[model samples]
Target: MPTLRDIMTPGLVTVDPQATLKEVATLMLEQDIGAVLVMDGEHPSGIITDRDIVVRAVAYGHDYGTAVTDYTTGSVFTMEADTDVQQAAREMADRQLRRLPVTEGGRVVGMVSLGDLAVRTGGSADETALQGVSQPSADPQ
Candidate 1:
């Protein structure tokens, strides 16, 4: 049962809520990440993803100058750094989230993405179960 701090990506990449979509997109590209946390000063406000840019901005024809928060998804979700990584993974799946802001003492400390969870729990029970079903069964006597 690893803690989020053990597998989380520290040094989160964030953008101000007032930042333009172009600016956020630029940051994502520069960082080579799919998601960016939107912050309102010291508090997390929302999140924007590369897919959101393509779907909301491109599909809706929102100007690049539009604020990133204008089309952010749902609300910001945070998990304590000391929490069990499996718990965070479960919450993310339940909420249909790909990532979460990692916190300690109510202050943003890092980020835990779906990729991180996959890496952490890659070849354990879940993978074994998946393999049991996906692989062909041998002939039974």
Candidate 2:
């Protein structure tokens, strides 16, 4: 089984909690990533995703200049870099999350996404299972 360390995208883009939402948005766009890990010192504090920008900010009419920490989901779900990809996938599914931060010794090292796991596993087991059931039944005659 592949480990998160093998599939995680290292050198992940991170933002400080005190940074403005606009600054975070610019960083996301520039990095071409959908989410960013928010750090306080060396520890991962929260995460800000594109959906947060829409639902937590624009949809609610919150000002973009406001600090990102105001809108970020501070209760982060994380996995160790050496954790099995299957375990990470299960955790993400259970938590209904698309991404998870990879950490080592309380320090953020990288990030892993559902897409990355799917690719690394040569397509998800769930997908393969669904495909198996979706296939046509054999003729009874």
Candidate 3:
């Protein structure tokens, strides 16, 4: 089995937690990426996704200047870089998470996304994992 170290995108584009939603949205658009890690010092504190902006901020009638920490998913889950990709996929599927910060020695090293696993694994397992991750639930939290 491949390890996350082999497939995780090995550099993170991050923003400080105090950054405004507008700034985060602009960064996501400019980078053409759906997610950005939110940092506290050198450690990842949370993740902000495009969907988060729409659902958590805009839907709540928050102004663009609202701090990202006000809406970012603060209960973040991280995976070790050496963890098996299959296990990571299972965890993501189970948690309905699209992206996970990859860590080494308690420091963030990279990120693993559902799309990354789907593209790399290329099998029924990957398809199943993708489907699981994509299924919508009544709970959006």
Candidate 4:
């Protein structure tokens, strides 16, 4: 089995906690990614996903210029770069998270998604990564 460092996308794009939702959305679009790591001066602070924009920003009727810190999900779950793929998958399953940041010494290094795990574990579909996992609450608070 491959280590997370073997399959994770390195040099991930990150955003500031104080950045505007509009800025985050634009960065997502520009990067062609579904999520962005939120950083506090090089330390991982939180994460902002596309769902966050739709549910927390759009659905809540908050302006795009709203601060991302106001809507970002903090207390992010992370994994070390050298962690075994199975362990990483299990952690994601336990947390009911679709994505997990790969870190080293409290700094963001990369990110892993359900698709990445499925591909590594020989699962049929990326969606199967969520199997045997509890569903996380949709509420962002």
Maximum-lDDT candidate: 3
**Models sorted by lDDT, best on top:** 3, 4, 2, 1
Candidates in order, TM-scores: namely 0.84, 0.86, 0.90, 0.88
- Which scores better on lDDT, 1 or 3? 3
Q: At residue 123, what lDDT does model 3 achieve?
A: 59
Query: What lDDT tens digits, residue by residue, belong to model 1 across residues 1-141?
Result: 788898889898988888999998899989999888888888889888899999989888879999888889756778899998766666665555567789999999998776676676673323333333344446421
Q: Write the per-residue lDDT of candidate 4 for residues 32-123, one digit (tens) a residue.
A: 99999889897878888999899888997888888899888889889899998777877777677888899887677999988777776576
Q: Give the Å error, residue 122, model 3.
A: 2.2
The residue pairs in collision within model 1 are none
Best by the TM-score measure: 3
Model 3, residue 58: C-alpha shift (Å): 2.1
Enumerate residue pairs that collide in model 3. Answer: none
Off by over 4 Å in 4: 124-128, 133-141
List lDDT for all candidates, in order: 0.77, 0.80, 0.85, 0.82
Model 3 lDDT tens row, 1-141? 798888889878899988999999999989888999999998778888999899988998889998999888877899899998888888888887788889998899998887788776665346656777789966967
Name the lDDT value of residue 125 in candidate 2. Answer: 35
